[model samples]
Target: MNDLHAVNTILADHLRIVLVGTQHPGNIGAAARAMKTMGLSKLVLVAPEKAPDRDTLAMAAGADDLVERASVFASLAEAVADCRWVLGATARNRRIQLEPLHPRDAAQRALVAAAAGPVALVFGRERTGLNNAELQLCHAAVHIPSDPAFSSLNLAAAVQVLSYELRCALLGDAGSAGQSRTPPPTAEVAAHAELEGLFAQLADTLDQIDFHKGRAPDSAMRKLRRLYLRANLDSADVRLLRGVLADTQRMARIAGEASVDKKIR
Candidate 1:
């Protein structure tokens, strides 16, 4: 295949656009059309308010095939489970413990990640955007520098903006690109599922050891998650951490049992 065709195929297969809890069916269709124009085909929908309807088909026009091919999941976590890198697009100024990336910079990083494994750019619902929990699933937040004075961008328009940036990055026209983080050759960065599993084990282990004392573990878990995500750990790293957590849990259980035995004696 030619160079152009090769790059196109790689991007189409490796990079996905995920929409979480999209409210309007029409917006879904419009977003699909925007993706098609930028040579993107993979689309994942997470628990939309309603199934695609006539309005959706009307908006997609010639891009109806993308709508038909789109994968639907019950949750954003499930939708991005296989993706190695996930970036959440946010318009809200809400605080999240994730690294923020400009649209252009996000595109560059995404292209680099796509070489290692499937990468995703996640867009949340039209009305409210992604909640804190959903945003946390992403490794970074991608923000478009629209005018702060009038920053309301249409759902489809937002998709188009990111799509265009991705296309530019794919074509080697990304100007003043941000640092591109290449995944390690020894072991590519872990998929979303692996990272999530590590996070779960860490949380459970912390609980077993009474790391939180009486306080809720939510705040601490969030910080821990951010720390690990920033580490860009691969599958080996995840396995090693999980092993440590498992041992910690076992040790903690043994200590608790010994204490109980002493009290009984």
Candidate 2:
């Protein structure tokens, strides 16, 4: 296998970190240290309240490189834009209608997803945890197993736990040295524009069927789009759905013509 692909394979087996709305520079420093300790390097920061400075560098110690190299984004969407799978790290349930995974299970799933493309585990603010809006962006939520009575985890500690799980899942005891044959390149999925086009066609068909007349149909159509987007439909799937919409519109037109003929008779 090519060296670049092999290296990516190793990294792909691991998990990535994204700190959202982090409040303290020291915590960011410590989180970087924790990540490096487990052999993970990718760190993304989203709208951090404090800037990384001398204080952060001093705290990071040997992991200063990670702190310095971390990518900063103004928005969570930008931070996770390239990620194919996103996991939200939280102690309390955000209750945003997503399935919850324990840290270990989430790590395993993240490993698999990473092989296909970039994946991210997002950590929320030190104070309030991830909000419902942020949690909705994630494909799933991960809760570190802790005492229910008092389950708050320090930011660095949370990173350590999840990063450790990811490292173990990726490297095992022997480490990620001997793996061969790079996995197939992850196929590029359909873009949001393509999906939107399909949704528009679907809504047009629904209108032909009189499905959206009296009942504010836009809401229902939006929900349907959400459901499909969550499924991560590929190009082939989008084409198939478009074909189904075409057939539905054709049938609706025929039915309407037949009704007009009966009325005239």
Candidate 3:
């Protein structure tokens, strides 16, 4: 085996290709072929509307093994729970708040996070693409700057593009100035599930304190998520934040009891 291929096999193993709500069964097989061509093998299907049939196998061609071993999940969160990094691919400029990265840059970022744990590159349906809610689960958005005059990219094509970029990233030449690969020490970075737990605790803490008062909490939580995610929090960071939230919730309960006693008096 070539030295580069040998090294990339390990890094690529940590990366997963996730497809959500795919409409056509053939696209699933095509997507598998794309991943296989670029040395990617892990495929995750999330609640596809249709089932794979004969056409699916026909499209897979020589990459049937990837399609055969693909993991299926009911939800995106459950699918990516163990991942430390996730990048959602979309063409439309949705109302999502995540920082967008070009395919080449996104590949670099994904590879870096692969050092710590599993990383996911998510692609949504062919028509509607990923919604804001699903994008929230991702740390960043991957956008391909195709011609605006004709931007309707196929699901399998999009996977092929991103997979190619990942392969180029592994080769360490992505055509971006100042582009370099230095896999940072990811020893302490929290896993995807850990970050999700922190957010859940934060939401509960805010509710206990009535922090939103009369306003909607979703907007606030969204901004807070961006802030924390940008900070690239580690395991110790999550623990500290969770500890503070627990204390705040405890204080809120105590204050609520005191208010009731005063009202009674």
Candidate 4:
């Protein structure tokens, strides 16, 4: 096997392709075919409308093994529970702010994250794409550029495109002489679940301190989530933030009690 093939061989083990709320069973099969063609095997389905059925098997063609081995998840969070990094594949703009990257750049970022642990490439539903809340869970968004006249791409086709980009990123140019193939030093990034716990603590503390003022807080919280996720915080940072939030909660409660005592006096 060539150098490119060797790089893809290792990259495949560290990357996972996740489909969220996939409506068509055929699309699942086609996606599996796409991944298999690109030397990817870990396929995760998040709450598909239908499980891998006869259509999926038929559409998968020779990649039936991937379909059989695919794992089913009830939610996106559950699907990427263990992944240190998640890149959402989205075509449309939404209210939530996310770091957007071209397919190639996203592939590079994914490879770096995969050095540490599992990295997920998430695809949303066929019709509406990922919801705002779902997108917030992702560390970044991968956008595939196409003609402005008709930009809509098939779900499986999108998967194929991203998978190809990832492969290219791993392989490098054939002309380049003796490029390094060793994986970078993996960062000790906190997992999604740990970050989610910190976010919960943050929200409660913010509420205790009236941080939102009079306006609705969802938008602010979404932005904050994006900000912190982009920071790629490690376990130590997460622990420190959570501890600070706990202290903030306690201080706010004490202040409230003191005000009550003053009013009573």
TM-score against native, each model: 0.95, 0.71, 0.94, 0.91
Which model is ahead, 2 or 3, in terms of TM-score?
A: 3
Off by over 4 Å in 4: 1-8, 174-186, 263-265
lDDT, candidate 3, 5-43, per-residue tens: 777788999999999999999999999999999989999
Which residue runs does candidate 3 get wrong by more than 4 Å?
1-4, 175-185
lDDT for position 258 in model 1: 100
Off by over 4 Å in 2: 1-9, 12-14, 173-226, 235-265
Whose lDDT is higher: candidate 3's or candidate 4's? 3
RMSD of each: 1.9, 6.6, 2.4, 3.9
The stretch of ten residues in a row with the least summed lDDT in candidate 3 is 176-185
Cα lDDT of all candidates, in order? 0.88, 0.76, 0.87, 0.85
- Pairs of residues clashing in candidate 2: none
What stretches of model 1 exceed 4 Å from their correct place? 179-187
Q: Could you tell me the lDDT of residue 252 within candidate 1?
A: 97
Q: Tens digit of lDDT per residue, candidate 2, span 228-255?
A: 7567777788899999989999889899
1-265: candidate 4 lDDT, tens digit per residue: 6975666667678899999999999999999999999878999999998888999989999999998999998999888878898889999788876777778777876877777888999999999999988998888788899998999999999999999887776666322222222222247989888888999898888888999997798987997897788677888999999999998999999999999999999
* Model number with the top lDDT: 1
